[model samples]
Target: MDILYYLQTFDHFIIYLVASLLLFGLGTFLFKWLTPYSERDLIRAGNVAVSLKLLGKMAGLVVVLQSAIRSSINLIDLAIWALIAIVIQVVLHLIIEHVFTRKTNLAKEVEKGNVAVGLFLGGISILVGLIVAATISY
Candidate 1:
């Protein structure tokens, strides 16, 4: 009958976990698909694409962190903020082609599926879970 009740339920946790994973996974995919370099080019240029993508995947840590904060902070507002961040990232990419020094990212080579990135994202999910659990008692 209360939010605490919801938090104790496995279904609630599963739903949150699954949804978070899917969104982060899908976002990573989209970023990869839109990246601008080929494997051949990276090979010829000393693997700059992978390096750059690694940075992005790492920096993307912030996105997942924010999402975790949003999960229990205010779901609706968090969604709106995420949309804004996406727009900003896209715009920044579009406007900075000349300043770019790396080859480009294809999304797949993000450190070979970026196990670290995946783990950190899941960690964020845990943070969300803890926050929800903590808030439930209040």
Candidate 2:
């Protein structure tokens, strides 16, 4: 009976793990699509700015997913929260790039290897993720 209970728990763990991974992949895809430049190409070319920016985005999404996994009532709820987190991160990034820094062309700067802007954007992304994660509690 104890073994049976453990097996059932393991099954749930697997389900959640797979679901979380899928959500993470989807979030990353959407983020890349929404960005102005190709993060993959930039990173491949040894652009530390793009690398740092992408890292922050990934880290932010992971933090949000962690909260969703902990607080969600079911798999569906987890999925919903994960989507919300992705949207929030992407939207906030756009807002910062377009609105907050109207004078500066962030995309161009990032492409030109502006580490300061990259670090600022990366820090903001992580900050937004932390805030969004904190709000995910039931």
| CA error at residue 94 for candidate 2, angstroms | 1.4
> Candidate 1, which ten residues in sequence have the lowest lDDT sum?
129-138
- Candidate 1 deviation (Cα RMSD): 9.7
Per-residue lDDT tens digits of candidate 2, residues 1-138?
589889879988999999999998988888788888988998999999988888888888899899999998989999998888878878877787677567878878888899888877887888888988998867
On the 0 to 100 scale, the lDDT of residue 39 in model 1 is 34
Q: What would the per-residue lDDT of candidate 1 be over residues 24-138, giving only the tens digit for each residue?
A: 5555555556555453465455654454443454355345435444544554444444444444454444344324324653244433455453344334334433343243322
Best by TM-score: 2
Give TM per candidate. 0.44, 0.91
Give the best candidate by lDDT.
Answer: 2
What candidate 1 gets wrong by more than 4 Å, as runs, is: 1-9, 38-52, 61-68, 71-78, 101-138
